[model samples]
Target: MKDFPSCFGESGVQVADFSSSTSRTAQNLVSCVYQCRLRGRSRLITVSWSKNLMGQGFSVGIDDNTNQCLCKVDIKPWLFSKKKGSKSLEADSSKIDIIWDLSSAKFGSGPEPLEGFYLGIVFERRMILLLGDMRKEAFKKTSATPVPSDPIFIAKREHIFGKKIFSTKVQFCDNGQLHDLVIECDTSAVSDPCLMIRVDSQTVMQVKRLRWKFRGNNTILVDGLAVEVFWDVHNWLFGTSLGNAVFMFKTNPSAEKLWVSQPLSDPHMLPWSWSQRFQDSQSQCLGFSLILYAWKNE
Candidate 1:
């Protein structure tokens, strides 16, 4: 009997051990999750959206040397299903009558090549999203941009309903220059609903109205400005909004304080009339953290 780490959090489940008999080399592990423990012990649960593989399911394993507990189970086989034609076939059905396609074809290829898994671990009041595989080196090179260690705050806006982020914008004063950074999520959308930004340890001027246009037709407009820079940001908020939200913070360099403004507004001029139908609002501030997830282009 192995002494496993005590499970924490409201989930009431602890992950004891996980492993796959299939070679981890040829196949890329897409995602893994530890579901509610079985019989009060951690049960390994995993999801692999791979096309090439078979016997795709969760597996459980224990470390023999450590006397740790382990379990393995196959959820579903990765076998393709074929549909028979309408013709009434005799006892000997031709194999050609059935179509052979990857089991994942039903869902369609999501991104491409099915890259390795990216794990976001939040432990002991800290958050870190680890990017795995060959892409790790590339991420390091691109993220080398000098980001402030003690940043006043960080915001990560993800599209809850949509396929991906419509746009990402960052506003901050760097070396006396007020800079605005924007990136389009998908060019075809022409506008984005979600927006996020972070400010370093510097106070911002407070005003009634602030506006800016980024890559997409998306525009941000904000009212009211307040500032406070402490506490992890994640615990303070929740919900799915496609607009800007104001976060207040005080700068270490200035006693007067400043506002870190994010304008969340509708993209009125977007080609799709449905775009106007989308609502823009802000959720409560959950908390704050400096760590965020970034992907490397292949």
Candidate 2:
């Protein structure tokens, strides 16, 4: 399969581009992309949360509708003396600001904070993207007018470390049921290595002779919604050490449309039918994409 661009690139999977020396799988990070509007113009904001030996930190990047980056700001962990502050920038003669407070934030195993934190992106004194539970605190701290932009959660990319079985919790829908996801693959057997995916302790998808079918897509029903699952495990089956596999779960209308659009000649180059979904998600939308970079822990 033709290797697609690293989905986790925006999520801090590879820090080299971010001018960091950390290895790909060394740091725990999560990248979430949101579709928001500012001054009647739609834009995409990428919020990345990272945690390493130094502690937790985050970065905010704003991109236009055409995917052109308007501005990017990195808040280093050491620079968080107040742990809550605002950074203002000029974008197209307009003021773009990023405000955050993580001093009293509570976190779980992941880099993202669970509570007592607020990260707000304000444009022209209007809050475009707001995260965390402290909405009132975020508005009060930033002095941003309460304009409801209603940012849509479009995509999420995360790195998961494991050996044979990788597990994580994800919610397919907003405020929906959170399901347990388990991916088990024993690649020790070069001849016959089976791959299985379980959701909520139930097998949702399985591939028996995974060697030949290392890269493909499947459709599984979750919460009465069809989820298109795309997997690329070519590195796991054949590659040097430190190789990682990529999996994407997207909620779409019809799985047949996703499969039929692909050319049958080359199955490896799985043309992800995301152009339409991406457009829909930005416009009249409520689509969620979860991308996991599974790293084998040796």
Candidate 3:
């Protein structure tokens, strides 16, 4: 109840509802957006990684200031012979090359690879966005020069599943230390469910009488920085048994807009408009946002 803002000016503010996000809450997916300078112009590249019965797949898209998808590519490289490959596409009349090698990539429970992989985006013979631990292999394969304009990771959205406690590790800021974030709640066990959030094994925020205050926003200090957190669990308490809850962590300095109802596609990705809002949130340079669609396994 403390440190939670209940107003924007004198009028009360409520979270916006995302068209849909429930179906994909249990899927293994991670979407990240990066901002980089291309030829002195700001650009954003979105990469989405997914894991399902068919195998692992990824998609890359380039968007300019106008929110237009200049070029995009989707690759399912899990087959034996196609584990590594390169794709060339033109965006804004500029040739762009995307390369990847997941032959030996290691993955955890989630869709994102843990290590042993290289996904590179090259432009004008220079590396713009390079991910994974295989830097040497990426540069060698791409034949691109290293420049000072590496991409800035601004936002990440992940879907996590659990029985009652959902947990993940994340970095709140660019080059910031990684911390463990955990959310715990048991709707069926109690008449009035409570919400608890912990960071690095320490309790940072908790809400009692969750049935009455099922939706709200609070601010917590992390690493000497203010982090705004918002949660909505109406579905968890009143919806079907498989309903999912929403949680978001924002690091915007002046972020008065707390995300509540609006949220996420593929059978496993967010919906069109929902995903659009997620990506659009990044274009605003709103520091970093981490949205977790926590689904209960019960």
What are the root-mean-square deviations of the candidates from the true structure over C-alphas? 22.9, 4.8, 8.0
> For residues 31-54, what per-residue lDDT tens digits would candidate 3 score against the true structure?
787777788776768787876655
Local distance difference test, candidate 1: 0.22
Q: How close is candidate 2 to the true structure, as a TM-score?
A: 0.83
- What local lDDT does model 2 show for residue 104? 91
lDDT of 2 by residue, 27-123 (tens): 6878788777777777778888887767778888776655556777787655656788889977767999888888899988888898999999888
Error of 3 at 28 (Å): 1.6
After superposing candidate 3, which stretches have Cα over 4 Å from the reference? 1-26, 77-81, 258-285
- Global CA lDDT of candidate 3, please? 0.73
Evaluate all candidate structures by whole-model CA lDDT and list the values in order: 0.22, 0.73, 0.73
Q: Give the TM-score of candidate 1.
A: 0.21
Clashing pairs in 3: 16-262, 17-262, 18-262, 18-263, 265-269, 265-270, 266-269
Model 3 lDDT at residue 248: 75
Candidate 2 yields a Cα-based lDDT of 0.73
Q: After superposition, how far is residue 116 of candidate 1 from its true place, in Å?
A: 26
lDDT of 1 by residue, 1-298 (tens): 1111111111222221212213222232232222222222322222223323442322222211112223222223342132111111111121101111122222212211223322221212121122223334323433422212211122221211123331222332211233332221331233323234323322232221122222211112222222232211121122122232222222212222212222222111112111111111012221221111222121
